[model samples]
Target: MHDDRFQLPADADERTLLTCFLDWHRKALVRTCAGLPDEQLRRRAVPTSNLTLLGLVRHLAGVERWYFQGGIAENYPGSLYTATGKLGEDFDDLDSATGEASFAIWRAEVETSRRITAERPLEALSTHVITGQSLSLRWVLNHMIDEYARHNGHADLIREAIDGQVGE
Candidate 1:
């Protein structure tokens, strides 16, 4: 009920608005998981789904690295998870997942992403790791906002199922 996300400004530059909205959504995802037990955080509340709050964190950690570090910075080492040719490992492998470590990795990756964004202008371009096509920082930022917005919705539902907690 007490939100700690960045308050979006009524008037701001494009970069500020994009980054602020992205950060707000990023915090919203973490807020969805706050104060929950590790086991509860890993619960697949949805029937026939592997989606979990911890998995979403893990997935977003990799996503941050993939988009900002890899796509924009062009220095992708590899996935934070899914290295064993096991796709969806981030969401499926939660047998031993811990909230502390997962959140830490997610935060670290997000910090790196902020740094990457700070170094470039909106018009700055980089190649997409998959499509091998050029993209601007602005595009990447918008994509990240979309990515987090979609996943945050999932997190909210999963959290609600876990403990009946719900909010923006």
Candidate 2:
């Protein structure tokens, strides 16, 4: 498949590195679902797991809103997919999931996240969404990188299971 992710610079400032790495992981996740039909993207390829590419996209959309918009910006609208305020709904409630809509929401949230990050300095702080403790933009960026990295691993396995494709 053709990968269009940004390349990590050998040397850069902290902010550049963090944002670029996060973006890299984000693109990697999308790469995992590339060229698959909506049905294939929504298939729980793993026999015993509920995970799907569409579900991952949905989950990350909520996560992008939760951390950047809610945790950092403090707007705190609420969950994107979960209506009853329950967790994992983004992944579990996917009977009607569509690749077009899921990807659109995800891309919009990611763009919002990028805008929020650009407006704040690395040291800027906001109240944590769950704990109400203070959190820095740096921490949120790092955490998001880790979050996407972990989920990208899951996406890789799911993609491989679906079509025998591999490599990030």
Candidate 3:
């Protein structure tokens, strides 16, 4: 039996490895809402702002885009505002015009980031646009993995409350 995971090396540096893990988990996170009831997708299951599961999915998509495409991949050419100039408030929009616009922005970012990862080797380092520091492909990959894992935990509680589905 074999277990397949995204981490490149068993003894790899935490930042590098976690980036891949985060990417996988984020993928899983987005998939969490797949095929769910539209009303449920639009409903906020928790007490936070208006973060519906669908909203989270869109939000993460936006985040990945901004991070990979905007920051690392594109280096933030234009503006990076998801919601009223607040990045985290992205999910708070809850399918509003801002949400819809951000969703499109996020989707574009994800697609561009995916292309970047596919084309570039993980060993190659990408410079953070604002920081002017080089970040290895491996590093960002792990970062994304960790980010998704954390949020998915939040999603777990929300989804379970909405539909009794949990884990992963």
Worst 10 residues of 2 by lDDT: 1-10
Q: Pairing residues by index, what is the TM-score of model 3?
A: 0.70
Rank by lDDT, descending?
1, 2, 3
| Model 1 worst lDDT run, 10 consecutive residues | 1-10
How displaced is residue 91 in candidate 2, in Å? 0.8
Model 2 agreement with the true structure over 1-168: per-residue lDDT tens digits: 543334555667899988888988898887778899988988998778889999999999999998998889988777788887766678886777889899999999999999999999999999966769788999999999999989998898888988999646
| TM-score, one value per model | 0.92, 0.91, 0.70
Model number with the top TM-score: 1
Which portions of model 3 show Cα errors greater than 4 Å?
A: 1-3, 6-23, 77-83, 95-108, 130-133
For every model shown, the clashing-pair count is: 0, 0, 11
Model 1 misplaced stretches (Cα beyond 4 Å): 1-9, 84-86, 129-131
Model 2, residue 71: what's the lDDT? 87
* Per-residue lDDT of 139 in model 3: 70
Higher-TM-score candidate among 2 and 3? 2
- By TM-score, how accurate is candidate 2? 0.91
Q: Which lDDT tens digits does candidate 3 get at residues 95-164?
A: 4444345446656766777777777677776776766777777776766776677778877777888888
Regions of candidate 2 where Cα sits further than 4 Å from its true position: 1-9
